[model samples]
Target chain A: MSTGAKKRIMREYGECMSDTPPGMKITFDEQNMTEWEILLDGPEQSVYAGGHFKLKLTFPNEYPFKPPVVSFKTKIYHPNVSNDDKGSMCLGLLRPEEWKPPNKVVAVLRLIQTLLIEPNPDDAIEPSIANEYKENRKEFDKTAKDWVKRYAK
Target chain B: MDPAGQHRDMMYCHECHDEWYRDEHGLTCPECGSDFTEIIEEDHDPRDHDDDDDDSMPDLEDHHPQHPLHHHDPFQPADDPEEGDISRLQWRQVGPGRFSVTGTVYRTVSPHGQGRDDGGANALGGFASILNNMIGGAARGQPAPEDAVHRFSYTSSARLAPRDAINPQAHMEPVDEMTNVLVGLMATFGEAPGGPNAQHPHGHPPHANGPGGGQMPFHPILALLNGMRPGNGTMGDFVYSQEGLDRIISQLMEQTQSSNAPGPASQQEIDALVRKPVTTEMLGSEGRADCSICMEEVNIGEEVTELPCHHWFHHPCVAAWLAEHDTCPHCRQGISKHERPSNTADGNTGASGVNNHGQMPGSFAMGDGPANDATLVQENWENSGSSQQDSSSGGIGDRIRRGLFGPPHR
Candidate 1:
């Protein structure tokens, strides 16, 4: 929580404010800017079109040096996101080694939107979901849509 | 044998070498009045375990697996030993089964010495092999136990001094003290190098010092002990091959990076980076941009460091990140091996307002397609939802979608 880290978080917040991702709304608190609550409406091209999903983005003390953590609070049924209480997504730039300091929250939001459009089954945290997505696309779609209705409504 | 119901707890004074049962006198040693006294918890002396027939060498058998001397693969790569695990004992191969150990002394008198301290164990192994050779490789016609440290459980009771408290003056005394301890260990553990009764200071059965054998066995040990003394470079570097040692050291350092994070860059590398003031081209279209590291707006004339990749940030800002990792914060290209001017033309892309977030597709690679900045996508939606923008950067937004998922699945 150095001043540099705080200033960076504040600046990222300002940038995220002006250009929030499509179908997404960000809620920020001045007191605890480290944790951001995001409300996302599932995109039209994806299976979860009508679903409203709540997500949490938490920044570590290392800030740009380390990647921000992204978790699904609304428990979406997806291959890349973990299927548990943590609901963490650790693939792509979300990974510590893959993350770069110049990458912004807008890029992260875009990644999430892109992931929803077509989940990356190859680098998946949920193997069963990935297997279903690869081997039985119909079943994966049915279950994903069903969960979006059940939890994300 | 005092009173049947009376508890007998023996106490030994490390300073004066006085032994008395604790019940008769308090913690203070009545003989020497030294506060440096240890309560010897075990009733039977450690030497008592030694007298138990050599046929049952259970103690050595129990601890042999953990000992470094019994290491299955000496040349196999190993992680750096934990700090303070062992001090300066180096095992150099002299012949088939022999090793000449060389280093300035290690004392295992502290409580932390309970676990795998390789120095003391190695010294014991050295003694075991040397004794095994001298006694015709057989203990009075029986094959000797390979490691004899089991007979001496004194590692627990030897409270000479804590490791941190050892003064320079006390250094010489420990070698002499360790010599006596080793001598006692040789007598108790091995086939008595000085005959059975010679070492028993309490004067037990077989009577003391039969002949010249008393001092004869001690010469080699004294020489070995003298070699172990601090600043004793007389032994020289016993390692036969420098390449083999270097390989081992390098392997140790490699294994030390067990975690995914790479080590920090040198300060000189961070210092040598080129610096320049913010210019109009370095700022966004609105003439405003921030150092991504510190996220502070870089006004014109404000100093910034330009990495080898031409991606720049506040001097202190980039330096901090480089200290933790050498790679450019924008591109993952390492500062040490950056491709010269390959992408320098597009390097100002970081300050190029809308597209800065779109660049650095390399950082987002994870089998799936890389992340493209959403600002372009937002612009295309604003321009017209379905019609593609004819601009080159606008064309990238359509490519971003196709790249993210397979070409236009919908």
Candidate 2:
């Protein structure tokens, strides 16, 4: 029996393929449903605007029940995202307790967009960006946009 | 990635083509005595991202942020100076029993630009405007409070149908457009999305997809419970009746009681959660801290539950949350990640004992069954064994060689 996840994922895939979310495009092997490569366009209003960020979303077998592991594939300067080999962004809903099984990949995509627009300094993975974001807005925006141009582009 | 696979602890051996639970059995292939094996974490395809590396990537550690002041450990000096509110949560009660929970949630979707101004405004905006004519239901002993009443009963379809059915708000809310599409798949298989509720393992496909909505499944029990009401008094009336409330309370109590058993989270595991007494310093300088559930500010000294993953939340919020699921709300990493294997005595379940009808519990006879599956193996063994026997068996050839060289060495 394909659990709720299999059917739900197919539905998500169809909807996303049919109506791609703003600034987000997903590509996955038809046979391999669990791992998907997402091409994310930076929010227009943000410093990272005009950049296309590459991200990989990998769902566990117990998806919905468990949050998908989303990581940045393209390098970009963001406060919430870890700038490392892992490139894992510490988003909240993907957090175990916050992850309602009903939540979809679409919501996660929305979250990434929101994070790009307004990075939270409190729970930042990259504190320097957060500090700069809090104390020096100009430098932060310039560096973020610079990284967007240099790497995310 | 193998989406269907649940167990991440599996290690596949190439030499013998055997699979071992890496958690139970250490990193060796027991059957063939080989060390070559690949670790698979829940069957996710080995990451292709590891291959791509750009040297231009900035120096990460130098740019990384650090939380230096008041690391927020459960045990800290109580007399620490409070800091500014850095958490992006603004809890504003719009009306009685209704409020817009706006915050920079882990995954969020609120119209942007509400900004930090709402906090100062909400503090002074309550009291006189706390719903001037508050609904008289569930008054909670206090004639009225300055703020809006927030009491509520959480219900799912698995519990009851009737009076709650009249509740347009409750029941059969599709999770998303995708859930609607999946419902079509379920319908093709002929399963009613929620007929008889919990009995349907792979849920009864919700018949009404409508156009779009949250796809949280509706339990069929909602109808059955409502059907039990006397006469044809309508499902709406019965849903709001005291009996309905009683039923919901009883269900809630039963669920809470069940938590003592090995449910989503074990009692011991839940107990291990850090009971950090809410303090001023933890909330920072602003006296507003975000709870894991509501994403609202928790008051100082309000006890919170901290998961092993280090995510903390209001005690009540986390209690209600943990009742449904086990993992830490924020990290998805298990609050109780280390689930003790049931049968630790015989962790190594070998390929040989897989088909045996009544084998000993821990006795996994290795290298017996799979090794003998083909006749080609016997032929090869016989051929190699005979050839080795002729040279090193030391029967006649070794004796002659020893006789010729007997006095030579001396």
Candidate 3:
């Protein structure tokens, strides 16, 4: 890549990944400029505790004009996330109208962290879990914690 | 000396004048010497000539039966008896060419018992008699007046003669029957002075001043009570007996009135609601370590192009995906192939990098090339200043300087 484009990419990458919360880590893959890896610890007091979740972030050539696509590499249980082993967190902030060019990488990471703390049931990708949570919270939390301990690690 | 006689003679005959004068076709009056063309043009009355021919018409003076100015011998007047002693008036020969008539007159008595014997009373009596005649005629099914004025006045002013004047007893029976029906109707629906249950032989509580006391006896509560097993007290009585249902209803009512209870869902509650297990398919293509397109392990050997907006598909997969939609499916970031140019000369001025066709190429194709020349020049421009500077300038300057120092340190 040309120096100017490389620099621009690095600058944006640095901004996006700048502030890692205490238990989270984010890094670009060694061999590629566009590939990134992120690690997150379950939020305290949440059913997702004791879990280490991994995520993959990929960027297009257009950089800041578009948002990076993120998907979980770890298996995790969440109502707002899709019901696949691949962690597909359904978040509104990552949507086009919600994303800003000036939004730093760290802000997005923190947003993910906050998501772990409070998932949005209104935008549930896993409707079954959402329904269970609505009908019976005790059973939902127990199942969620069991899954997190068994697989998210 | 007679005005009417003089006027009749002065009226000339146009036809006679035309016959006497020159045999011209036009009409002319001999007496007035004026053109009578207008009068002759109209349909002339043949009756006028018929009257002239019958000069021996009856002595009109003798035909004036009620002329006030004519004298009649009292004995002869009494002796001139007509049917019902009613004399019909005749047309009077008032002058050589004029005629007049008078009507029968009768005395009338007022409702206040004052007798009016003069012609005024007679006129009034005549009108009253005509009215009575009409009523009697109508009662008997006789033909009434056809003249517009007479018909309107007779219909509007005529009253049915008193029952005494007609058959007196015919009116009494109906009035008695009507009075009986009205009394029965008033009694049937009337509220009992004491209470409604007064007639119920079984002693029940007098109907309470509750909702259906007087006017609306068929109110819903009353209906429900009526439907209840007769021995069972009314619904109101049953409600008073059930404590639990009433409490429940009261609670519901209170809850509705307050309207301040916390909503069913809160952010924390929602977050808790979504705590469930997610599977691989839910993550979509991005979650797959292997590229479906190339059918190879995605993270391992396959050469993958990652979009700057942070979405990874195999290079070929993304290329195909970009061909269809310019935005990333996951993040919805617009991933058009055309980059907005820094300068307008490059023709990408708007925030939306769409071309004139409003189509934006996918992200994979956005840049001119991965290593375009202009970008190289701009990098060179930025680097030159930094590389030539020292640590004293700034952290960025030192970094650039060190970068230019390059492989030596590595």
Candidate 4:
């Protein structure tokens, strides 16, 4: 009955999951107060298509005041995500400016989904991947798809 | 003179101006009344010594004898009748009229005449020797002749006589002695003494016959009798008696006991002593809206937990609140877990919605509890695995693993 930010987030998650895509889910860690995991389906026709990318969201004690750390658990190749690690997406939702106390878990999840569709090469976590995407988009897509299929299920 | 007047005048003496008789040759002066002696002069021849009148013959050669006695009748001058000439053997009248006579006694060559050849030096020496002996005796602490005179004769005479010798009534008994003998004598003559009861003389008793009459109380006797009684208890034996000592000790004990007994505890009415409820202004200073555990606005009358960090919240809220976190809900400053139930692990778990019946997180509520929880679990699992792998590979494996694994997979 006492609804704080975490309660509101849980409520919003249940509401959002009612219309969620098949095989994709988001839930909070049972043991931890601030960690969350999300299973996302790769968008159709993209290099990550047919892949299930897992992402971990870890919030600090000062939640909403500061952004959570979002990283991918499924391997992928992208300019904004490190290819050496599994699905390590570096998104703006986790950025200091984009985070505010009013921003909810649903909003953060939506932001992560948007990052999957269009990764920002300008503020990329992997510079080599960003360069490959800039010089040869075809080769970058190919490497990203192959890694997603190999690591992400 | 008229005969009667002359007779009256003849009755008074000339010297005394009183009546007197003058039948003899001696006449008395009327004012001074002194008897005058008749004067007579005799002629003496140098060869008139007669054996029959040896006593009347003068020793002319030894004119200055050791003891010379002269006799003269009253009011008559000495028979010698010498003049005032220092060189001649003459008598001079020194007293008034002819009462005294004096003449040239003698002339001495030297007062101390030991001998003519010694020039009186021996005599002077003898006198000095006697004076020295007297002074030396005194200096040596010897008793002077005057010391015996003072101790014996003079002191014996100076000693006071007994009272009986000095007091007229000392022979009579003190209690029976009459104070006024004259009054007693008058009573004996059938005349009553003048006093308050003198008019009722027959009805009155004798003056010294009443109880304690004419006899004063003896001060020393009264003092001795008063001292014999135990009224003051000043006597050494009375003061040190067991009964007196016990009473004193008991009195002292009673005084001490009464003084030491604690006074009664006054009824302290519970009015201002009771604590008042915390106000909104007291809670609002920390910028906290509601109780962190209950998620309810802390009311004015509600008791609250106050942390040393100047944060306040409802008592139950903070107790359940601090159990989840070991710091202030608003400020995140460290607070002891033992201080509140909320700070303990159980309370924290319950407040974090870990219980079967999920409750909303208080101040530490996160966005999307399920999603946040899944993320935390995945991250922890991956971090734990990576750390284990890194440790198994040794120090060099950490850098190589970081180059291979990059940031934690999650």
A104: Cα error in model 1, Å? 0.7
Instruction: Report the C-alpha lDDT of model 3 over A55-107, residue by residue, as the tens digit.
Output: 88776565443456668787766776777755666344354323323233444
Task: Label model 4 with its docking quality class.
Answer: incorrect
lDDT of 4 by residue, B1-410 (tens): 22345322122232333323233323454455555321111233222233234333256434433332343232232111122211222223322221111112111222212222221223322322332343242111111011000100000001111111001211222111111221222222122233223333244442332211222212322322232231222222112134654565445444543222112111221111223355544433233344433334545666655653344555544444344334333323334322222322232332222310111122223323333432332232233233233222222222222222233231
* Model 1 spans > 4 angstroms off: B1-262, B337-410
DockQ of each: 0.18, 0.01, 0.01, 0.01
True contacts kept of 2: 0.00
lDDT per residue, candidate 2, B1-410, as tens digits? 23347544666565665666777677898788788776755324222223134223235324435545324442321111112211343444443333322222111111221221322223222211232223222111111111111111212122221221001223432211222221222221122222223233334432332212222332323423322221223333223335675675556544544332223666666776789776655553233554524434456666777664344665655655566665444323345545322122122245321211111111111122222212212222232233233222222222112221221232
| Predicted complex 1: CAPRI docking category | incorrect
Q: Is candidate 1 or candidate 2 better by TM-score?
A: 1
lDDT of 1 by residue, B62-110 (tens): 5323544565443332211222433444544444333334332321222
Interface RMSD of each: 5.9, 31.3, 20.2, 21.0
Worst 10 residues of 2 chain A by lDDT: A95-104
CA lDDT, candidate 1, residue A120? 80
Candidate 1 chain B minimal-lDDT segment of 10 residues = B161-170
DockQ of 4: 0.01
Candidate 2 overall lDDT versus native:
0.46
Q: For every candidate structure, what is the RMSD over all alpha carbons to the true structure, in angstroms?
A: 26.1, 42.0, 36.5, 53.1
Task: Give per-residue CA lDDT, model 4, range A7-113, as digits (tens).
Answer: 54455456557645344687766566467777888877567888888888776655534457778877777777676655455444355422323334554565555
By DockQ thresholds, what CAPRI class is model 3? incorrect
Query: Would you list the C-alpha lDDT of every candidate in the order shown?
Result: 0.55, 0.46, 0.38, 0.38
How far residue A119's Cα lies from its native spot in candidate 2, in Å, is 0.9
